[model samples]
Target: MKARPAFMLVGAAALTLAMGACSSSGGGTGATTPAAAPTTAAAPTAVTLTVWGPQEDQVDSTSWLPKQEAAFEAAHPEYKITWKNAVVSEGDAGKTVQQDPSAAADVYMFANDQLGTLVQAHAIGQLPPDAVAQVKQQNSDVMVTSVTGSDGNIYGVPYTANTWFLYYNSSKFTADDVKNLDSMLSKGKVAFPIDNSWYLASFYVGNGGTLFGPKGTDETAGIAFTGTQASDVTKYLTGLVKNKNFVNDANGAGLAGLQNGTIDAYFSGSWDAANVKKALGANEGAAQPPSYTLNGSPVQMKAFAGSKAVAFNPNAKNPQAAAKFAAFLGSTAAQQAHYDMRGIIPSDKSLASSASITADPVAVAQMNTVANASTLQPTVAKMGNFWDPTASFGKALLSGDITAANAADKTAAWNTALNS
Candidate 1:
């Protein structure tokens, strides 16, 4: 679990009022009995909060979930919390909650890509003002947008970002050579997952194609993968597929090739860091996505960026407490704890300069890509219709079904199918 929750509160005025009430209760009579020791300041409120996350985070007593829950309890002495935790991956949260929001965990983890679905189902709660401020303060703009609902409200607290970047063999190419796809291909073999829809869009996006709208939030704008700019990218990819040094990564071929010394560079997120390190050893290198020349001009390839976030159920029995716990799970301190315990990179900007994060190449690459080379993977419900069509289009390109002669027609068809 990369995401941790945070809840910071202010009660100075309340404390003052409480002190005033206590003083007045004594009535200046100076009761020697001490008035029963101030009646124990009223027992803390009792609350039951159900939490959901992947089993990996709670497989043992020493796991991240139990440790975090214990910390939440200790920090919040205002409540005696009874925790009921269930196994639920962030990827499955939206569908599970939609099945029965009322029965959903009070505080749960979810991928930000599911924000629209969760919002449409009325299962996810919008963040309170304090939490909203915390989210903005802790994350990059791209990460903040990843958890924003269509209504322009922030819906969750992000603890870790999700995005891909370039990983390469530093022994084969200089740092400058890796900055451009053409430069890398000219130097050594490069494996790219062009057949995967999630990875395929970078080429077209690097040119001028847009998903949804310029910011990816306008559902009606649709995917703008048409026109000359998009077709030019398609034509470029047609030539790219025929290049001797270019390998179409499929079925884990990219990572396998790297291990066997057949591939010098690949594209992936931090999830593959350990494997990459094992494959390249001292030669391992990571960077944000590179530019590829199109029409004799440099264009930057951008990946789809999102986050894994903690959200509270709007229908929870203890709504306020649930929301607070969700916020706590994404706090800076919690993010730090998550990273230390599970090796999950924190999304909090305050940790960017920390020794642990700065020392890790994969972490630096992922954070830099999110902040500079990626666009928010839209949370709009319409985005559900995108994957298959683009994927089929990528397959067609890889199979020679799409080429210079048919690039325009195929590109236009892809755009139409996407809108349909």
Candidate 2:
């Protein structure tokens, strides 16, 4: 799901990108070697740098951003850090800067998918030589690909691999119960957003629906949104609305339910972990999204996994300082602090074995899910066409406004929405 494109090239790129597997690997981390580092510039300098991140969303949300800033300052006393109070979100940064470069933060936090747009507008700066080496050495190959642009230059440093997974009340779903979808639905109250395309696509992927062509990012490939496998899976998941235990948590009523003990489990990401723990305390548990029992067998779930990264503004006054700060923000110490203080699963591979991360149930599940089972979300401009249509289709199916008998017709309507 992405914001609509203002140009045709990005849309075409995204559609093509979605139709084929990426130049990297299928889904998350693979055994492949990292891409060779590109040529870069000189060292960062001593200057005032403005930084932006979603620290307000943390458990101790208020302090984590400042803590990182203070640490960054302590290490590089020549650079002064400025915290910009704003939303750490997907749609804001790229478009705003594309419109007016001067307004972009010296270093800013943005979702992985927005990389293409920012790069297109020339709003992001190329990484310095030291930063380039640090990124490849620190983060996984998958993350490096996510932040790299069409021009082949790496534009940012990754922090969190943003994706969804299962968060359950340990007391409600036993160890065995958390392994599959139907089992969880059969025994407990599970809240999921059947209307959100990003979340809804899991069912189709688990059941063999393919989006990008054979490899995943082939420009000549095509979308399988209404193909046989997708239709079959969509029909099957639509049938799940009949389950008495399922609740639509699209607008967060489900989060409330999970917190108040009314819901047994919920489907979400690290962003929701803090509140889930506050709600269930000792009972909070997490696992990869369970497979669905289909044709008397289980189908593994595939999700849209991605990174939340920091990039330097091409227009920043203290260009070198911003580049250094951007690199510093994704460093091991900062990532660990994010995990310890904010519950954000870091993109850095070295920090996985740390005691704080190892002890956290949510962090463990997230890492397992991304490294082993999840698929990378396509970050092309065509992603703009996905969200609203799929959400509308899912809602219509889940609410009983449409059925298998009319599913094809409904899909045709969904396509029309995509075209519009």
Candidate 3:
């Protein structure tokens, strides 16, 4: 794990309180020994900082979050920790915090895609120069890129590199067998949530479709949803939906099917890796999602890559304490704790390739996917338009609504949606 050098804590008063004691009873010899006067160290001023995250992290006593809180308090004796259970996700932070900045948690874990909005709303504050340098030195470039604002300021420390890849029952599919989606579908059931826009963006991306241009900051450039490349992928998806092996597992139906043995393979990220592995047992294996044939050429399927980051609230009652704790939460030890406790994939390069992460199929799949083949989820507000359109396009494709004759109309509607 990467060494997370935190703030320099000063506790001279606490150390001085450790004075020695003398025998008060004189070994019961009836000689009264005068008790030494007790020395009390001046108490440090207490500062309470509020934090937020998923329910599991907030509620589980054995979870790493509480452990992190304890350790943070131990390091900074003057500050105390208070956790608030909130479902506010990264995408929700901007609008929600903008409504009531004082109500927002001091330090919260949010997705990378919402960084732009958070910065726009002024909900999150910029990282100090040293913390920014530490984040860059510790995490991958892709991760660092996600949290950086358009102004080129670092806003948060990333905790997990979130992305999807291929997972198959190793006992049923060989390494080569897992390389092609066509082959995997031919073997039987494979759960791919075609209705999900997050996953659908991958096909468009794989087919050379760009969303909000390369860096994801160009709103006027819009997205690519009506081109020939899109038609190729859509047509490809249309064929697969009719295949008996295809299963539309939106809203976790795919994962459930995989666990219940009705599905042979699943396309998802690290969050579902542990449960899916439990379902597959020794047969569990994972790799990057396989390619599909498009116009006689194989098109590599891409995934919407993202990260879970810790952002310090600008309205924090204790900005200094919040910043210090935010650094602690993203520290290498906390990342490893998250894995050990919740099996979350680590973003730090040290923990990303560690034995614990590398040995696990889920973590390995994510690491390989992010490093080799994945498209960054655009962080601009315009990205909100891409999700529904991609999902609707997938829904139409699955329904066989995009035949050659109707492809133009469907493409126009999809493009209109994208432009909206």
Candidate 4:
């Protein structure tokens, strides 16, 4: 399987407030008799901190969260972290929070793409200065350029280091048959999340193109489908479809095909490792996407990297404490714990050499591939609007609704929506 980029988009909020109310009465120093001294202060009433994220369900009941909760509780006896699992329907977690604000978890675990919307909604808050410093000291790389928002405030701490990978059911292909993209395709058709434009970006780049050209240096920075790049990318994709090597079933039926032994391979993200394991029943293999031959060398596919981080609710009652927890989650210990249970890669470079991760050949190889060949970029709200239309173009190309020459026109229509 080849790697494809996947974007997690969070909606921004409008306003954020601070909510901290004392839960206990203070004791007087001079008035009370010797027999009436304050007794243990009731353990600060055990504040329940709420947390939200799409990975909540992935946190194994016996393995991960319970241990983390116990550690956090032992460290901060006054706080009790409450996990609230939220669904990321339609690629956005904002809808989940919008449905209920108070019930919305105080801490949100969000995709890198959705940070903008969360910022706009004012649902996320800046971390405390000390906590930010601590996080910087704990995991500088993931924090340095990874979790910062557009406004220059730190919104979240990365909980999962995610990347895309190709997952294949070996039963569909013999050892000799699964050599390269063309060979794999020659054996059987491949499936992709055509509905997911971010995932499709890998296919675009694999053919020597990009969604947006080089950042900062190119005027097209933050723009999608500009230049002749998109046309070239579409042509390659059209060729794949025309050759009957790929199918476009945007509703995940294509993936279902691979799972059911109808297809050989599928493009999926690292986050889907567990799902793929379940689908393939422990007899699957994972690989990096095949490369396009450029200058006599096979240039591997450079897909998008998807990351999830924990952000504080600006309106939370315990900002400082929330910040502490956020920082703790990014620590190497916590990251390793998460990887142990979730199969996600760690953002911290130090953990790259950890025994738990290295013990698994598939994980080690995938992480190395991601580190060497991957691109990370933020996705705008409009990109969400572009997904369906772009997927429609993929379907058109696959179904012959439109010729390769006209793919630009279809893509241009999607770009128009993206820009709108």
Candidate 5:
């Protein structure tokens, strides 16, 4: 999950009471009848649910967690809930929950990359039909895919997306110019973190390479980074590095360059929005990743995308309530509140389409990227083998050790390492 500052969240509650009086007359005109026997309605069910989320959300009584808890309580007056909240960051929720499923929070937030682990441990429950419909209806396909297990079941409700997009200086490149990376490079200095494995695969992915499977879940399929297309991408990167307008962002070079005005554009995610805004001021422009020309055709650069989502523990005492609350946390209204209160960009499509979200370029670009120009980062355990080897290849590219002459050989070796 992105490291963000905490915000205050206040919950509003509304209750309605209905009153009625009844009387009956035995005779038409003269006789008065006794009132109907007094009756009492059944009491609401009492449910105690333990919820967990990042410390940022639980920082105070007015934070996102408390506000949502209060709202859930108000929304469902059928259940009188006693809330127990703990500080467990989304990134660590799966591991912690797996340690003791019986002791885990009934409902919790987690990064989508942990879905497989949670599924393997049977710690996360499959969303109910209503919740499943909401998840598909409210979110983009990528957000929906992120929380889906290998067995094709929806496991959670996604709230915010995790992905990178293009941040540029509007003064240097127009909207048309931003459509193609080569165009941006020709116009002004551009920085890309080719040496980082996280950003390195964008080019290859754009040129028809894939991780795991098309959806990134078929472990037997492995990585598809060899063959002609992958080699072509390698050759393209070789030339891209030699371009005077291109700068390989290593360490903090990209942001540093943007800060110093040496860089006109860089590739990054929402986490860098504030810093990029501060650096560019009036000229800041954000957009989905641009395409690069491959073998004379334009291919869209696709980043690895995932989501931060809410899930219920199947083993919880009140599984139904836990599931309902989990769905509520990722609901459209809840996501809108999350964005408003915490500046957390929402993954919910309704909120993404709202005027409030569209006004923010970073938020718009992120949603656009996730919806149109990104691949799902798979949660399979073998995905663990991908990083170190890809990073090594990226380093080699940055070092200029793999030129067009050796791009094919080097590319083949990288593919081998990925599968190995």
Candidate 6:
């Protein structure tokens, strides 16, 4: 599913009132009728700090943006933050920003894939040193390393912590039926987006394969795959599709299936849980993707980690104020508030165990699973180019027209596209 970005800033009315009240209180009481309490000149109108993100069709104004904006404005009373809405119709945020710096917004919400591209292009500015230090002190466990660019400078503040989970129809499968892959397959059908190659990676990794070796290993650093491992993943995926164990619902067919009680499970991100629960009923069960056994123990799945972070445009008109606002966003209180308003998990380790997050039993269990499993590095500019190729290859593979060897060749074609 595509992500829709929403940006909101509380109006200056509250601040205006607060300033006015302060002025009146400080002024002499001799002036009856308040002698027009010196108009506390509106907080120095900082350069309109423009921020853009894809429009969210689902978020209600009262729920997500307004709340965040009110909190941000309340904390920073000296500057006016003007939020602009920009939608990315094609390519990623990095490419969109590079297309026109002036037209590009001062602040942008980018998915993980867009982060590297923005850093590589030098389109993003580093977090002010003081801001970084403050964030570190507040939440020590949130590694600044995750948001650091290839240039070894921090460019963004981690916002959303996303992972894939198995959203199944409770009406279709019982808890006992979903204990393992075999039982799941035997009991009900599974569905996911077939156009994305990452879905394939999720399945392969869930079954104990890695796109890259360990945490420190670079995915593009020429990691080799054994023939046996390749065959195993390919065979497992193909067999699932061929046996009608998994369904590719490219045309909302899966959702229809879900609504009709035909499909058993759907693999999707945590953000979709709310909608999934609404559709399947609150009583439905959610679980982490099943693990594949290696040796004697169950191995975890490899899922992509998508982060939504706030970054300043190097060409922002109000660099200092914008920087300050960005820093405020990374503050402990702000991070927790954001998480509370939206069901998004906070990147701050300090808030990771907070009651708001852990209070939801399902969310807590899924998060625990994520902590145990490794995450795939988010897509950057280079990886964005691979999305189409991977989707095409996956489509062909599902159609029974492409073999594992051909799919490998298709992957090579994707690499070539990235270079081009």
Residues 1-420 of candidate 3 have per-residue lDDT tens digits of 333234311233333332222223445444334434445555665676777777678666667778898887788777545555565665566677767767888888888877877887888989988779879987766778888888889999988887889888887788888888888887868878888888877777888888777755577788866667776666677777888988887778777877888888888777676787689889898998778878888888888787888988978887888887888899888889888888878788777668888788778778778766687787777777777777777888777777766776677778788888
Query: What lDDT is reached at residue 236 by model 4?
Result: 60
Give a tens-digit lDDT track for model 5, residues 24-72.
Answer: 3333344334434335566789999999999989899999889999999
The predictions' CA RMSDs to the true structure, in order, are 8.2, 19.4, 10.5, 15.5, 9.2, 12.2
Residue 154, candidate 3: C-alpha displacement in angstroms? 2.0
Q: Per-residue lDDT for 98-128 in model 4, tens only?
A: 5655556666666766666777777777777
State the lDDT at 97 in candidate 5. Answer: 99
Estimated TM-score for each candidate: 0.87, 0.74, 0.78, 0.68, 0.90, 0.67
Number of the top TM-score candidate: 5
> After superposing candidate 6, which stretches have Cα over 4 Å from the reference?
1-96, 99-105, 130-146, 171-179, 192-195, 206-220, 242-245, 293-297, 339-345, 349-352, 359-370, 377-389, 392-420
**Each model's total of backbone clashes:** 8, 8, 0, 15, 1, 2
- The residue pairs that clash in candidate 5, if any, are 9-62
Candidate 2 vs candidate 4: the lDDT winner is 2
- List residue ranges in candidate 3 displaced over 4 A: 1-47, 58-62, 73-96, 250-253, 404-409
Error of 6 at 269 (Å): 2.6
Better of 1 and 5 by TM-score: 5
Clashing residue pairs for model 1:
4-329, 4-330, 5-328, 5-329, 5-330, 6-327, 6-328, 6-329
- In Å, residue 401's CA in model 3 sits off its true spot by 2.2
lDDT of 1 by residue, 106-206 (tens): 99999988888899899999999999999999988889888988889999999998999999999998889988999999989999988788888888887
Highest lDDT, which number?
Answer: 5
Where does candidate 2 have its weakest 10-residue lDDT segment? 213-222
